[model samples]
Each structure stands twice: as C-alpha cells, then as structure tokens.
Target: MAQSSDIEWTDATWNPVTGCTKIGRGCDNCYAERFAERWRGIAGHPYEQGFDLTLWPSRLMQPEAWKKPRMIFVNSMSDLFHKEVERAFIDQVFDVMERVDWHVYQVLTKRSSLMRAYLHKRYGSSAVPSHIWLGVSVEDEQHKGRIDHLKQVNSDARFISFEPLLSPLHAIDLRGIAWAIVGGESGPRARPMQEAWVHQIRDACERDSVAFFFKQWGGARPKSGGRLLDGEEWNGFPWQIVPKSIIEQLSL
Candidate 1:
C-alpha cells in the first residue's frame, strides 16, 4: 500500500526500489540512509543492507493495487534510475505505471544521465505517458546540468526539485521546464538556506510562469523551521490541464 507522504509536492509514495549509494553532496546526509540504519534490526529488511543500491521486486506491482487516482512519488527512498538498477527491472517498474494508468507517477532522479539514456533506448521520440511526470533533483549550482539532461527525456511533463538548497543559482533557464520545487535542508547537522536563494527561484518561476512549489524551511528541525516564505507558504503545481505541452519551449 502507498503511504501518504509528508512531502507537500506529492500525495503518495511508491518505493518499488529502496536504498542507494551517495553520488553527490545532496546524498551526504540522506534521510533514507538514516532511516535504513534505524531499521537495520528487522529480519530480511529491504534496507538492512543500508543504502547499498538494493531493489525490491515485490514492490514493483504496488501501484496496481491502488484503486483511486493519486499523485505518486516513485521511489521515495531511492532513485529508480540508479546505475545499479537493471534495465529489465526498470522495464518492470514502467510496466506497472503503464498498467495502472489511473495514478500519476512523478519520478525524480539525481542520476539524470541514466534516466535520459534509458528513456531514449526504451521510448525514443514517442510521447511519455501523460500520467507520469518526470523530474530531476538540483541542490546546487553544480547540479544544474541535470536540468539540461532532463530536457532530453520525452516525458509528457518535466520538472526540477531544488531541495536542501545549498547555494544560490543565477540565470536559471527554466526554458523547457514544467514545474520547479525548492526547499531548504533539515535535520541535525543541517545546512542553512539563505532567504535569497528561495526568492531567486521564486522570481525565476514567476518570470517564466512555471509552477513553483516551496517544500520547506529545513533546519535542524524542519517542523520548527516551517516552509513559509516572506510570510506564507508557496504550494503550486505546473500543469493546469492534462496532456499540456511541455513549458520550456514556450517564449515566456
């Protein structure tokens, strides 16, 4: 069963895969890694291996069990497009999404290279399923290239997640993007997010008329930090209608 996620951007989570190795600074203090270690004692625990890039074939069909429509975050605990994930397994994950067309799956990946390569090999120029929204995580200026990589994929909708925001990003070319989600880091040993960073992104989204969602003000305790910006929370979605054209190509 999919659990309702605390993540404000999406409604539910489906972890067809779990556990992943650190590939960037965003992985330095992964909540998934911490959670896995906390549950290490459980017998045959999926994350008992603790962020070792494990896959759960049993979880592949979870979306099919859900009868109602939902906005699902695919692999909340891991990256579905991780290099270690086999192509056949990726196909199986997609199989479920294609079969359970009632739900909208939002797949976010830090490894945009793998995602782009896989999509090209599998779908080519054909349209991506309208129910599936693809996204890439960009925590800092260095990771911005992931956005360019995401543009190459053929998903019906494409977006970016700039959570745990570390540094300021300038001249953000939201040219081909559908949505933009921004947030600060949270938890003990947490990083501080400057107000300027949040506003910069907000302004960019406004200029491009892209949908912007502000996730949280992550500090040592996100609950205490809250997600308010300039006095209020920004929770917005990109698509107003189904089967809309990808936004980056539009001239603002």
Candidate 2:
C-alpha cells in the first residue's frame, strides 16, 4: 500500500528501500531513523530491523495498483541513492516508476553526486520523464554544493528541499531549479532556523523565477511554530512540470 503522508508538500510515501546511515550533521536527528528505531526487535513490524538498510522488492509494484493520480514522495523512509542500496534494486524502483507513469514521483536524496551520476548513466542525452521529478536536500550553506549537483542532471522537473535550513544561504543561485521547499527542524533536538536565512532563499527564488514553499517553522513538534512567514503562508508549487494527464485527473 502507498502510505498516505501528513507532509504538506506531497500526497503519499512509498518506501521500496528503508534504513540509512548518517553521512552529515543533517542526519544527526533524522526523523526516519527516529521512527524506525522505535520498532526495533518487535516481530512483524515493518521496521523490526531498526533502521538497518533493507530493500523491499515486494513494494516496487505497489504504486501500480493505485488508480487515482497523485504526488508520491519516493522513499520517504530512506534515500534511494544510499551507497548500500544495490544498483539492481534502484533499477527496479525506476522501472516501476516508469511503468506506472500516472503518478508524479518525487525522488529526493542527500546523496547528490551519486544521484547525478546514476541519472546521467540511465538517461544519457535523453530527457527524464516529466512524471518523475528529481530533487536534492540542502541543510546549510556548506552543503549548498548539492544544488550544483542537482543542476547537472538533465531533467526539467528539478527541485531542492532546504528543510532544516541550518544557515543562511546568502546570494545562493537558484537557476535551472523548478521548485524549493524550506522548513525548520522539528523534533526533540530541533535546531533553530533564522528568518534572515529563509528570506535569502525566498528572494533568490523570486529572482530566479522558481516556485518557493515554506513548509513550517518547526519546533518540538512538526507544527509547534506554525506555518506563517512574514504574516502569510508560502505554498508555491511548480505546475508547469506536472504532466498534463496527471493534472487533468487531479482536477476530477
């Protein structure tokens, strides 16, 4: 089954792969790891392995059963590009996505370089399908290089998630980007995000003609700080990249 998500940006979550190891400070308080660890040692639980990297080939065809078109966040529980995930498994995931072309799949990852390399090898000079949107996660200025990696991909549906915006990305370039989602950390060890940091990216998006969406002001809880930014909500989306067929079905 495609898990329905509470996340504001996407409609559902599909986890063909689960579990990941930390490679950066952004992974310190990962929400996926936190949730999965709770079920450790519990028999019959999906996360019984407690965040140990595992692949579920059974779930690859899960999306094919869903009739209605929607935005599906691929691998919400783990990164598809994680080094441990086999290239064959990743190919299976992509195959399912290509076959079930009705839903828009958002494949986000912090492993930007690996993702770029894989996409280049898979599609080569050909354009990636519009139904599959590729994106990378950027937590701070130090990791802004991920954006450059994302730009190297040959896809029109490119995006970036600036969640847990830890530092100011002053004068950051947003060219060749279709959308950006900004939000603060939300958990027990949640770090504070400065308003000045958000303005920099929002302004850059405006200047670059990229759609910007402010997810939350995250606190102890996901909604502890509310979604308002400068007295209004920012819920921008890139409708241009969405396939016309999906858009038409969504309206119904």
Candidate 3:
C-alpha cells in the first residue's frame, strides 16, 4: 500500500487484507479490481492471486510502524467485511486499529449488514473509537439502506460515500451522518452524473448539517471533468470528529 495517496480524502492506504468480490452495481467497474488484475500471475506480487479475497496477516502491524499520525484508509483495495473473511481475522484487524491509536483509520465497506453486525458484536453497546471512522458506500437510491445501517451503529463519526453515483439519490436522509462524499463513476465505461443528482445531495447535507465533499466529476479518468460544482470546489471534511490529539499532531 502507498504511504501517500492521490485520493483527496485520506492521507494514505493500508491494506491489511486485499482483494474482494463484487457485492453490487458499485463494484461493476472497481478501480481496485482493475489495478490488482494487472499484476495477476506475477510471482511475488502482492496481488498475484488477482481480486480473490486474500488476508495479509503480516500487514496487521503496518500502522504501528508509522510513528507519525495520519488519516489511513483501511482496505482501500478490498472490503474488510467480505463474507469470506473469518471473524477471528476481522478481530485482528480491529485489534490493530484500536491499539495503533495514533492514526485515524477510515474503514469503508459496501457490506453494510455484515459490518453493522460485526461492530455490534465487537463493541457491544459501547461506541466504536472515534479515531476509527466507519463508513459505507451508497451508489444510488437502491442502496440507501446502507446509510440506515450506518446510522444504527454506535458512533458519532459515521460517514457515507456516493462515489460512482449511478442513479439519483433523491431526498436522502443524512441526519446521523457526519460526512458525505459524492462523485461520478470514473473508468472507461463511466456513467454520467447529472447536476441535479449532486445538488440534491449537497442541499440535503446542508439541511442535515453533514460535512459534504465533492470528490470529482468522473469521466474516462478521475479528474477528467474537474470537481467544480456550481463553479466552486466542495472539499468539506468532518474535522469535528477527529480527536484533539491527532489534530494537534497534524498541525505540528
């Protein structure tokens, strides 16, 4: 995984586990799958097995090695809650995240139900650590239930990503969410995102007081169309959720 990421949101990516199966329409043109497949069958390559669920137990301690605090995106190339992953393994990943403490980890997944169940089991009635911000991906209205699942979790740092935004998510409720990222699909077969669809989300974020971030206006490439929305770039972040210690270190 890269120590630095080009992603506008997080600072770096740490893939303690890699590879995942497609769970929905959002996975149709997965950039992670495309990147991993390119290294398929190449001996000694991290993704030699392609986008097949593989656990990297050795990488569990990667975050601890980094002394500096940063915003780390966990499992960017995979979904940590994939059904194929064992409960014990998931525990190890969480264990590391909890112990590391210094870094803020963004664990995003499309497997909303599984994540909700696991978090309930792991933390019981207590809230998850604020440093470990949990989130879900909602590509359209059909997947709006994911947001509901996220809200059910016992945390105030919940967020949602509407990237590769396929269809209009009309009048979605963003009440419990702290942050929302919206963007169009980017790839060879990228789908066009209507301005009205984005306006709906941005306006709702304002209404619900959720931090809104407009990632990109996707095309053949991520930045091809630019990130301008109403002639301005929206890069809102949930700084309120980040711990004070991390904020102090970041400023240093």
Candidate 3 residue lDDT tens string, 48-118: 99988899988999999889999999999999999999999999999999999999999999999999999
Error of 1 at 26 (Å): 0.9
Residue 162 in model 2: lDDT: 94
**1-252, model 2: which lDDT tens digit per residue?**
455778999988899999999977788899999999999999999989999999998898899888899899999889999998989999999999999999999999999999999999999989899999999999987899999999999999999999888889866999999999999999999999999999999999999999999999999999999999999999999999999988977531
Quality of model 1 by C-alpha lDDT: 0.82
Report the lDDT of model 3 for residue 219.
Answer: 97
The deviation in Å at residue 18 for candidate 1 is 0.6
**Comparing 1 and 2 on lDDT, the stronger one:** 2
TM, every model: 0.92, 0.98, 0.98
**8 Cα displacement, candidate 2 (Å):** 0.3
Model 1 C-alpha lDDT per residue in residues 1-252, reported as the tens digit of each score: 456777777778898788888888888888888878886756786666766677788888887776656778999889999888899999999988887877778899999999999888888889688778889999999998998999888764898999879999989888778899988888787898899999999999998888889888888776668878999978787656343333332211
